[model samples]
Target: MSEYYGTTVEDIFKTQNKRFRAEGSEGVDAVFAYDVQGEGGGRWKLTIKDGACATEKLDSDDFGEYSVKITVDAETFVGVTIGKIDGTEAFTAGKLKVDGQIPLMMELPKLFTKYAPPGKEVTAADILATSESRFQPENAEGLDITVGYNLAGDGGGQWTAVIKDGTCKLEEGLRDNLTVCNIVKAKDFVDLMLGKLDPIVAFGAGRLRLVGDMEIAQRLPKIFSKFKSNASEPVEELIMLKKIISVDMKYSTGPTMGKFLNGLKEKKILANVCPKCGRKQLPPRECCAVCRCDVDEFVEVGPEGIVTYCDIIYYASPDPLTGETRETPYGALFVLLDGCKDREALWHLLKKEDLVDVKRGDRVRPVWVENPTGSVYDIIYFEKVR
Candidate 1:
């Protein structure tokens, strides 16, 4: 029984279906073929049946036969499996490539259990302690930048990576007149260093703060080596946290909303005109959010409208009520009706051929259901108006 730390694609595939089962929990179905380039790199196919995954080495590497073909180096494959580099980040960085079934490939995380290699807590200090080794001399060959890091907490401290002409030196203390600063928590910084946290997501979410040149901040990840955690601490007495927040809620919809619902039964879209601002609101509300006055007058808006924005959802959980997974990449449309005033928009699904080539300001007409009950689904979905 060998340990899991010596990460190899072949070694990992051999031990599956025993300790853990991959239940394609995201309702994805595909056969994934891996095409690696490097020493001992070879072709392998992973069949994801419903939610379960099983792997086999392919004798002939014909990528066109598989549902998806992923291309990467041998190290990246090992790195991805061991959590040193995230697949999405790798793809974004152009270190990894996927030939087909991209959405299915995105569901790869469900096919493998998170295996934490056995090791002691490699602190953030231990990682940054050898920061010089992580820096790339080539990237910063003639670059001069001072980056200050402040990781606050019990196990946190300030450190700086000062680079000059391609050489980066790590100091445990603060450095003055820095080019940029990144302030993060100790645990989060360690996670980010180990590829457990995506820098892109972190920066997007404001977890990783940048004070100065963002371009210099962007260059740091590429120049540095990825930190690998030796062992992941197991959860002992880990409470399965849950809380049920039940709210018994109902909306009266007032006279304005009530009239709007009535209009819906007759297959009409209505809006309320505000007295103060003269603003029109669709799916009429009692009072306008913009104007503090009552919206007394009602008028019909769009039987045909323009799409303001649309999202083509490729993957998401199955519908709770229907227990049905939709054939994905469906368009969720936000439409501004023909007669609507200002920026108020209604939500609807864009169906049929309308799903293709949908863009902003594309004209759409509601497809009403036959003899509809006053449900919102009465207009089942909207379609492109030719």
Candidate 2:
């Protein structure tokens, strides 16, 4: 039996349970019958219950009413499952035939995660050979450097990339006086080249060791194009629209929040003190959540505080205030200000430059604007106090 893209018809069915999305299967009760033809093909019944799925192989005796029944060749079934062939195109070409409910069959892809074949292991030699081919001469103008790779462990060997005069050449073994030498395991080197491992994370984790000029190491990615896998298939590009929809709106801040925003103009981080329990509300709420008592007295907390929690946001959507998208990788920090008690942490942004070094218990001070605004935007963000 032949396989399509390293995936057999049986392989696709066997891994269906692992790929099944329980969340998507909620309230979905249906049976899907697959009558795959050709070698390595067989009849199978996939039954989905409330947040669960089960697959049973059928013999010549088994035949039951199903919500949807699909008939296709083994190779086409495997190809479509792994995204190598388009299912809609196959159906139009009469290679794939469907019976029973068409809408249920159309929504089948959402019921389970996309099937991914176990890819062929990429070797270091395969990556090193493409150095010259993947080099971008346009980005390498006036560049002269030797990047040494002292890869160790299985399938490991020394190699050097001599980049000079708008060209790059891969050479076997390392040479003396290298600009930057990278010491890492061969498996990690392969993952790093494939972008499976982030270079910053690997460096911080000590999995990747770099010596000599650090600046050139950062520029290497720009000097070379990304490496492509030999066994990978082309993916369908998704259509995306960049549009900003703006709506003008305003709301009354009320007495509690009004004082809070007004205090920002005086460089104050105000929190309302509860008259009963003494628990402070970071944004100066009208009532204390614990004691249910009115909070009228407000006190200043901190322009500087210690971070209780930090998150480096990589995929930030457009800001609601400005309707403009921020740059990639910004920090969202929850800070425990000096005068604030437990559960009274103020939520704010941290400086982008400080994200790499910021951790819990780290001291941070707010970086305010020249002219204070009567809003939370008075301070741009917080930065680590050196």
For each candidate, what TM-score against the reference? Answer: 0.54, 0.44
lDDT of each: 0.77, 0.87
Model 1 global lDDT (CA atoms, 0 to 1) = 0.77
Model 1 residue pairs with clashes: 23-51, 24-51, 119-231, 140-166, 141-165
Q: Candidate 1 lDDT, tens digit per residue, 191-246? A: 88877899889878988788888898878777787766656555565455545556
Looking at candidate 1, the ten consecutive residues that score lowest on lDDT are 1-10
Model 2 agreement with the true structure over 1-386: per-residue lDDT tens digits: 66877878888888889989988877788999999999889999999988888998898736587888899999889888877899878987889988766557645866998877876788998998999999999987888999999999999999999999988999999999999999999999999998889999999999999998999988889888899888654468666675767677799999999999999999889999989998889988999888988899999989789999999865455666564666657899999999886899999999988988999999999999999989898989999999
Name the TM-score of candidate 1. 0.54
In model 2, the Cα lDDT at residue 17 comes to: 91
Candidate 2 is scored at a TM of 0.44
Tell me, by TM-score, which candidate is best. Answer: 1
